[model samples]
Target: MNPEDWIAHDPDPVTAAELAALDPGERAARFARPLTFGTAGLRGPVRGGPDSMNLAVVVRATWAVSRVLTERGLGGSTVVVGRDARHGSAQFAVAAAEVFAAQGFSVISWEHPVPTPVVAFAVRRTGAAAGVQITASHNPRTDNGYKVYFDGGLQIVSPTDREIEAAITTAPPADEIRRRPVHPDDDTLVDAYVARAATVRRGRHGHPRVALTAMHGVGGELALRALQAAGFDDVHTVASQFAPDPDFPTVAFPNPEEPGAADALLRLADEIGADIAIALDPDADRCAVGIPAAGGWRMLSGDETGWLLGDYILSTLDGADAATSVVASSVVSSQLLATIAADYGARHVVTLTGFKWLARADAELTGCSLVYAYEEAIGHCVDPAAVRDKDGISAAVLACDLVAHVAAQGISITDALDRLALRHGVHTTAALSRRVADPGEAAAMMDRLRSNPPAELAGFPVTATADGDAVFLTGGDQQTTVRVVVRPSGTEPKVKCYTEVGQAVGADLDDARRRAAAIELQLLASAQTW
Candidate 1:
């Protein structure tokens, strides 16, 4: 990745010129190597370097995808390319389509901004060879990404990701790749997605007041369509964030899980006295929910929402055969979902993090059905058959449906959660993330934790501690007290700690939550000191 070599091969003049202008130190640092592509695909600052995500990088990545497709006997097959409303997303998406077409593959381009899950849906519905979404999810405005999905509508996995990276190593210059832009009528795919999303609705209440925000991304319009189609007519979107704006004007960050990100949506819900509130990330693959609390509204954590939705879905299958139900959650997520599934005579499966692992849980657990899979990061796969990925739109519909159903019975979501606490244990989860200037700092922090494994946390004896890429620590019995998982973020330059604590339903929920927060802060505080 020498500067001159990259300059010679790069097709985009802007990036080439940028590389040419950089000093030796800058050039070496920027072009020392290509950005690594893991389960999350390629992501970095949207600039003009081999380490950046620009037109040249897109072309090379698309070329790699094309080669892998061809090697797998999918030479002339179609690839679905979608994008969000980021700065270079549309251009990158079209460039990807051209590269696919040039490689003798058919191109299915969105031709406009769409959510990441739309790419997954289009791939599954069209039987395309693969799908590429030009987005960065909830990353900063200066950043962008390329997320790849495969034939079965799952993100590209281990051996395949490595293969694509290998092809990228020797990709031809961008100009040498063929280019024929093919645009399908966008209305067809959109209509199909809307229809499929509406099918997840199972409610007895009509038009319960709802409030929503897209966090200045592409999910607003599509989510509106799906919600209205699913009989939620009284939906009110936060006006300021309804349109797509790459700068994310209203909040410090666009992710709903962040502190101030969902403030505008909750404010609107309060102003309108809406029954429920919804927040979708920049690209809308994940969802976060809010419900009416004691005095105002409180946004539910990802695990709380995931458990509520999983329980709701399972309750609908009250009189089914043994093949009726299967639900899943990530290993780091709360185990209450498993308890609920078992109570309902359903099977529960736990997989590694990411929807790519959770999406195809049905294959891993045969016989039972695949009803739901969720993670603690606001990701839920409610309708796994339709979109084999975490789908914010469908999850929102299910959330609203749950609200309306409960409202029909004179109970709010708060009451339902209380009942769940009484039925199952009061399981609460918290997360702590420490940002560092360099990723190496994350490794160092994890090393420190592994070296001095805590025998106890928050006055509770540690029952177990395991280490690999991360350090997993448990305090007291797993059913009570705490579970701590300290790991580097799959993406981004940060180390994250996830903690879930529980107190038996007859005990105090506040006590469990306070102790969990204390332990989480203690771990993160220790990391800061290190």
Candidate 2:
């Protein structure tokens, strides 16, 4: 569509003015292609045009979602709509709720910002036909998104996402779409979610001194409430970051996985002599942990936290039927969770690199339940039964419980990790992400790597290769095994390569760790070339 046509259809005068101000070339670029909807839903910059996340695009997307659900015999069914504290989030969420209500669906809308997982949890609790959350998660402040979840609380997968996109293509113009004002629901659901989240904690040890940061997202108040409900009274929060601020002035990026993102939390932890530190990303769906190291303090890598939490959760499941309980992780994550699950007599499965896939792990195995699921990007689904998505709030509560439990056992989190290493070998993991100018470049890089597979990386010969949306290479000698996964990121314009090296612990655990770290660095160096 041309700029004139887009402006005519745009519901918001601001975006329409933005379209009017753009030059012909810039306008053409903005309308060159519509935003592609996938399993993760629509994500883009908050600007004018069909390709951006303006009010018009949101209305059309909601109309399409309503159509898809209606076609599945869910026309008047309940739908939960929520938003985060990002720019344009409130408007988009309201627009979405109106569209759903106009389509004859019962809409449960929130007046205030809520975490992404809270929306997911509400879908299951209310038996809603679907849920939509207007959030870009940890993305930059300029970006926004629309996330969709199906009846079971799991994110919409392959065919469903494709169907929604197709429906979106057939949607009417924004001005033509019907709308109905929706009254915001009460906080009963929020209270219910907090209660359910608190239940994830096992027998409580004395409250450990915990430090937390919300990373300027919407998780702070609810996270604190959940922890307090679980009997964690010694929790301290970074006041500067506890409030939801869309600008994210404190960090270069809103994501907790980025360097220096958790610096303030760590500083507070050190000042208070905290036993554990937690950082939740902008939307509070992903979590990063900080701990005391040989130096002042260091944030645990996603894999390290994954291993610790996985071990703790499995350890507490003393009498679960081994064959009926399952734990899952993304293919790109470290395989240490598999070892931990096996030790506890539970089954482990690997899915594609997203909670959407991990959430459905239990469905593939007959009579099995997903006890835990995590990805290496600091995303953890500690209570899949309650919320079938990565939930930083519940994960934080459980992490605190893990700290208290370990303290009661007369050991540190580091000691628990070392014990796991001794039993399962020193498994080290690292990732290399290379940014490109555009998505095409990222795809081209993946294609090039796939077409010309390297024979070896970091002195380890490539013994096997598996090809799909990503490429997997396995190689090593008898003393060690190396695995590398290279793929284009689903949400960003970059190609990511994940490497893991496993070595059996010898009499000197330090020596084993040193050897593994060296190999991991070499592998990362090699991956940089690709």
Candidate 3:
């Protein structure tokens, strides 16, 4: 794995003209650092040489993907492709479709742009061998990615990704790819996805006063269709930032979690007196929920929404056989779910921190109905039967439905959180991420933190810590459970540091809240010095 040999298997220019035409800077960049396919699939800025996610790289990757299916006795299988409204996304989607078709696979393309999750669900619904989504998933505007889903509609994990990377890096020349024409009706997957999402809708409360924003991506239309199908005839759309634009003109970064990404929707909600505001990321697999609280449309953290949604689902099911197995990430908030599962006679399991892991793990862990699975990063899987992967459209419908169910009890979302806090004790989580300019630098930072462990962080004495190859999990499991896991972002140069603080108060919410906050401050301060 010499640095120079990373792209050794990549196709070289057969004709001097092709190499001559490549941008000098791009050629140099690719030569210096070829794209490394990781567990998260291929991701990088849409620039550089053949190593980047440009047309040449995409074609090669598609060939690699096709080769994978073929090797697994799944070649020429149906392939469903979806795309977000990101820059170059549409082109990438078409390129993928063309390549899949050229490889003799029937490609079920989307006529219009659709959410990333819809594509994953469609792969399972249509019995496709695999699916591909063209999106970066909240990354900066300059970047784009290729996310692959296997036959079961879950992302490819560990060894599978490694195998795919080998195929991609050693893929044949782009010109050698078989070219085929796409039929007029090759994009029927959109209709199927829209229809399937309709089944998850449980209707809204009262007039269904809610504001919706697509963050200038392609999810708004499909979201509206699902909302209307669910009988929410009055889902108000935010006037601005509602259209599907590749550039994402309205927001700096198309992610809804950032400040002001939900500003337009909140402003509209305030003016219309809406009960809730729903914001979906550019690709639509991830979504954020905003409730009318604290005088404005206050956005609920991923953990808060998971608790609210889990509570609603658990209480609504009437039968004793209505089993609930609450699933969450290793880094997510387990306070509410752990308590609620006990009360409902359900088992709570912690999996590695990704929707792919949660989805696949839930399927593996037997003995109970996998009620709900979510991670702190706004990914949620509501009906595992319908879609084994996270679906923003389905999550959006379920969130509104939960609001309606709670409205019947004359309670607001904030009040529900407070009651949960009273029952399960308070667990507040905070995250701090620094953008290391180089991947090596990010690795170095994690190395330094591991080699020189802090004896005392802030005020609390460091009880114990676990140093992983690429991450570290530190802090005392009692009083405050501080988890500091650092890894090079699968898709970006940034290295994320996750911290969680939990306190068990028998039933005293105030005491738990104070202790959790104090622990959080201590963890943050300690992390800052690192």
Candidate 4:
């Protein structure tokens, strides 16, 4: 180990030593590429280089953030940090806190593991300049992440992410990044958030009973606490996977949207004869609901759940001046929300595909009260007053409340959705993904799609084509979108392509399902080239 290697190679002492210790192949794998930070923040496989999120990289990131905050007049501002049950999460959280405290900034670290949303809420609720959460979200166990949220209580946006990346690039070295020991804040931010969520919207009648699953994450306690506070006592918490375990022992993947993901919770719902099973992702930022339908438990897609929530909220407006305005992402199923908004004389706005944008907009906007906002990825923001970001706890309670209302009418969420579709026409959403090994390959795929744009897809004219990552299409009164959103996932080897298609509703359920299936095939055909 030559000292000159530190000067010629990596400047960071910790990273340099770690790299030197590794063999040739190992070092090449670790230093394959630099960490790419974007709207999602810096995330990578837990490995050996500055590119990956090792201990040294984590320290560098925190120190860089400390420098940025200080330069931005938020130098002495306090920060609240939290983590989920992902591997190395607690250690990362502690490292961040120590770095911030060493920089003379007050730190309030979580006493125990908590959800990502809770950390976002604490950041804003406590008037901190920024917050960090250590979790890989729904990614595979081999992955982990560092997600940053701003004062506005949303994930750090574009330019901000770039600036933070620059800060990290300019840091002296990993070991030089000052870090001081700090203890967790005695304060209870999640408790206060739970208390506030309880008051989202009191039903004049009664709250619905619900079966809840944390997907082996950290939302069970908060969900239970909020449900009880909201006057719903019949909430049944799933016994298995209820406790927070970073390993996620039960499920292959911790996402609620994945196939067979909610099987355990569905079984529990059947056992309890519960009307619905509510499942949240590991970070508690995304949610899914399953209702007892035909012979088995049927789970609703993210768009379906958002539409149900939107319809319920909009229906309650009662054509008053205080009509609810629904907000959804540009890529989400806008047909349902648009129809409801038009019929009820409410407003609807479309933003980029991220809850951070939705939550920040909800917090900043004043004229219209945001009743509902959701993305097709299962991220939802119900009440900005209680939480500027997504809240699975609030979504759980809202799910119960909506289920109770529909059950009173002797129908399930599926039936209600059918009715809505029959009245305003049905719409279906779908996605197509192309995975590649390297970021360069992902970029090349996008370039290929851009160079050879499809004029028509599934016999429908391409409405618009985005050369960058996504493509959009529409046909007749009914519209279908085939987006080729290409990006190297923050925590995985594969790049993702999100595609969607929609069709008008008919009198029969089978017909609607058939039409949706055909449209899905067409969308898939078009995505083949992309």
Best by TM-score: 2
- For model 2, state the Cα shift of residue 255 in Å: 0.9
Candidate 2 per-residue C-alpha lDDT over 181-267 given as tens digits, one digit per residue, 9 for 90 to 100: 999999999999999999999876878988999999999999999999999988999999999999999999999888888899999
**Model with the higher TM-score, candidate 1 or 3:** 1
Q: lDDT of model 1 at residue 160?
A: 88
Question: In model 2, where do residues sit more than 4 Å from their true spots?
Answer: 1-3, 464-466
The lDDT-based order of candidates, best leading, equals 2, 1, 3, 4
TM-scores, all models, native as reference:
0.96, 0.98, 0.90, 0.90
Query: Per-residue CA lDDT of candidate 1, range 356-378, in tens?
Result: 87887777565666889999999
Question: Model 3 lDDT vs. the true structure?
Answer: 0.73
lDDT of 4 at 461: 65
Question: Candidate 1 — which residues are off by over 4 angstroms?
Answer: 319-324, 477-479, 507-530
Q: What digit string (tens of lDDT, one per residue) describes model 3 on residues 1-530?
A: 23233234333333224444557665565657767665356787775355466666777788888888899999878987877777778777888899999888998876577788887878788788998988887887888889888857878776777777788767765656665767535545676677777776454456558799988777888889887777777788876788877677788878887777888888888988888899988778877999988776788988888887777766666556445455444443445576676677666667666666777655655666576777777778887766777778888988888777778779988888888877766768776767878878987887787778776654555643443445555556555555555555667677776666667776567777887888778777777666
**Candidate number achieving the greatest lDDT relative to the actual structure:** 2
Count: clashes, candidate 1: 0
Give candidate 3's error at residue 123 in angstroms: 0.7
By TM-score, how accurate is candidate 1? 0.96
Residue runs of model 4 more than 4 Å from their true location after superposition: 1-18, 204-207, 318-326, 332-335, 362-366, 476-491, 506-509
Report, for all candidates in order, the number of backbone clashes.
0, 0, 0, 4
TM-score of 2: 0.98
Each prediction's RMSD to truth: 1.9, 1.2, 3.5, 3.2
